[model samples]
Target: GFGWPVIEAQASSCPVICSSNGPLPEVAGDGALMAPAEEEEELARLLIQAIHSFSTRSELIERGLANVKRFIPEKITDAYIQLYTKLGS
Candidate 1:
């Protein structure tokens, strides 16, 4: 399941780092730094990279803010309405 933490971080303008498994990648989109769930070393490298690179952090923050807009109330409701309409047809 997609969790609120990612959304919260994005909306708060914090750069996110999440595992590449499950719905995390979908929720994070291109707004996060992702490594395979079991790849601790890779995750560490990504964390270090993110810490060292101001531009990377800035880009992630911008993209995360944009990605979170997809979850706004109106959009979620509209998406559900669309799906229901499609299913009923």
Candidate 2:
């Protein structure tokens, strides 16, 4: 699934701490910190970690900005165009 919040957070330069459920871990990748989906305590811990770790927050913002580039509208369109071109060949 396309996780819009992840992208939005990344694009907005916010630190993202997400659950390691579904495509969140895959999509957020290294750009965001994670907690196990079923563990409420783990989620709280990660949130607390993010709040206290200035370097971690900065790292997330940096990586997230880079990750969001792949989802830029023009970039996605380019990928489709490239795929169609390859198929045409």
Candidate 3:
């Protein structure tokens, strides 16, 4: 139900390696290298790949930081306001 790991990793300028199952893909977006959830070996491989691939990892960190901004309080409040306005109409 929660995917705080992605945000935490991104905030620290780390590229997240996450499972493809659940809301991980949506949460991690371009910030993560995703592998099938049940595949431990694939997940490990992706993690190693992330570590060895500096350019890709850097891009993921940048994208992750941007994605994390969307969840900030101000953005959340704005979204709430927009939703309320739509619902109130």
lDDT of 3 by residue, 1-89 (tens): 76888888888888888889988888787778888889999999988888899888888889989889877899989999999999999
In order of appearance, the predictions have TM-scores of 0.94, 0.90, 0.90
- Model 2 TM: 0.90
The prediction achieving the highest TM-score against the true structure is 1
Q: Can you list the residue pairs that collide in candidate 2? A: none
lDDT value, residue 69 of candidate 1: 96
| Superposed model 3: Cα runs more than 4 Å off | none
Q: Stretches of candidate 2 above 4 Å error?
A: none
Among these predictions, the greatest lDDT belongs to 1
In the range 1-89, model 2's lDDT, one tens digit per residue, is 77889989999999999988888887787899887888999989989988999998999999999999888899999999999999999
lDDT of 3: 0.87
The CA lDDT at 9 in model 2 is 95
lDDT of 1 by residue, 1-89 (tens): 66789999999999998899888998998999999989999999989888999999999999999999999999999999999999999
Q: Poorest 10 consecutive residues of model 1 by lDDT?
A: 1-10
